[model samples]
Target: MARNNWIAVASAQHARRGCAIPERGYMQVCHGKRAPLQRVAPGDRVAYYAPTVTMGGKDTLQKFVSIGLVKEGSPYPFDMGGGFVPFRRDVAYVPAQETPIAPLLDMFDFVEDRSRWGYKFRLGLFKVSDADMRRIAQAMQVDLALLQFESLLF
Candidate 1:
């Protein structure tokens, strides 16, 4: 199957936490819902967009915080203690800057309505066009060639 590009919405703090996890592995989406993670496969590209500094917070910080390729494996439950377990998928995150989305708002075809571009982000996780993905990678200062090469190995 052809690889797909996905955009996941999360808070900047959570997105950064996902990237900082040991081995640069694992991402949980849609509040750790397994259904969303199940749609992703090994080699697929994943980028995280944060609209706030903290979950449910008013502090705005719209940015593309993390970009990486999904690693081999199905989603597995992770014990966060407090009886809260969330499903997570392994990912090989790459180096990238936290890029703002304001400038790129007009560049994304997926954002149909620039004024209400955030509608899709409400879905938590969704697929994006390859063109949009490339544009995001560029905005985030991510090396697409490296991501492609890494994807091929999976």
Candidate 2:
């Protein structure tokens, strides 16, 4: 499958737990509601962005915290056994070095204004251009070669 690059925003706390469990990799969003997640496909490349500095007693430094490869699955609701079910997609995730988005703001087309780079993140899950994805992967010090991208003739 061709890998489509994606960015998903999560709170530091949730991002921490999601990265910790890579085997059963799941990116939960919208309290179990599915919309954008349903559009995600297997083999897609996902970069997780944490907007806050700390979560669940862990300090994330407010940065892009993890990267993952989507596994073979569709959006499914997992019952946490406490009436807490969140829609999620299976992913093979790896914790990444904290890369603050501030430095790379100018490199992304999604960020029109340097001071408001975060405005785009309001949409929890969204597609990112291959260039932006590569830049983000570079900033996180992760290898983007692992993801296979569809060729663009233009």
Candidate 3:
């Protein structure tokens, strides 16, 4: 099988504080002294933070499905599946119906649909380098922000 880069998103703040691991949680942040380099190598593992409906965002999984990035009936690879990991609702989803129900389909619909449908995810065509991510951040000139998660591929 081909190796895939896996991005792990967690709620822990350890990554921002420069800690190797969070004090508690099923997963740890990917930051700090031993922070995995920017790019996920073919066989490395890492984690980061991501938004979820539970965390105050729309249904992220639906976005994956609309983009044809994920398929149904597949086991979610990351822990805390169908929860925790939230993506931007407007940018990341497809409606189950030809047109989503009004009011219900509003941005908040993402929040309501929590656990309503099975979600699958796959990375898009953005295989960028750590240096690239860094350079972009640098060129745009923002805080030395770490991506919200870590990823491993083997």
Query: How much is the lDDT of residue 153 in candidate 2?
Result: 26
* Candidate 1 error regions (>4 Å): 149-154
- Per-residue accuracy of model 3 over 65-137 as CA lDDT, tens digit each: 0110121121212333655532210111111111111222223311335454222112212233343333322
Q: Write the per-residue lDDT of candidate 1 for residues 13-95, one digit (tens) a residue.
A: 98889999648567998888999999999999999999999999999999999999999999999999998899999999998
Model 3: lDDT of residue 113: 52
Model 2 worst lDDT run, 10 consecutive residues: 145-154
Tens-place lDDT per residue, model 2, 8-90, is 88876787788786677678765567888888898888888888755434654558888888888788878888778778888
The lDDT leader among the candidates is: 1
Estimate the lDDT of model 1: 0.89
User: What is the lDDT ranking, best to worst?
Assistant: 1, 2, 3
User: Model 2 clash pairs?
Assistant: 32-87
Q: How far is each candidate from the true structure, as Cα RMSD in Å?
A: 3.4, 3.4, 15.9
Q: For each candidate in the order shown, give its overall lDDT on alpha carbons.
A: 0.89, 0.77, 0.25
Ranking by TM-score: 1, 2, 3
Better of 2 and 3 by lDDT: 2
lDDT of 1 at 123: 97
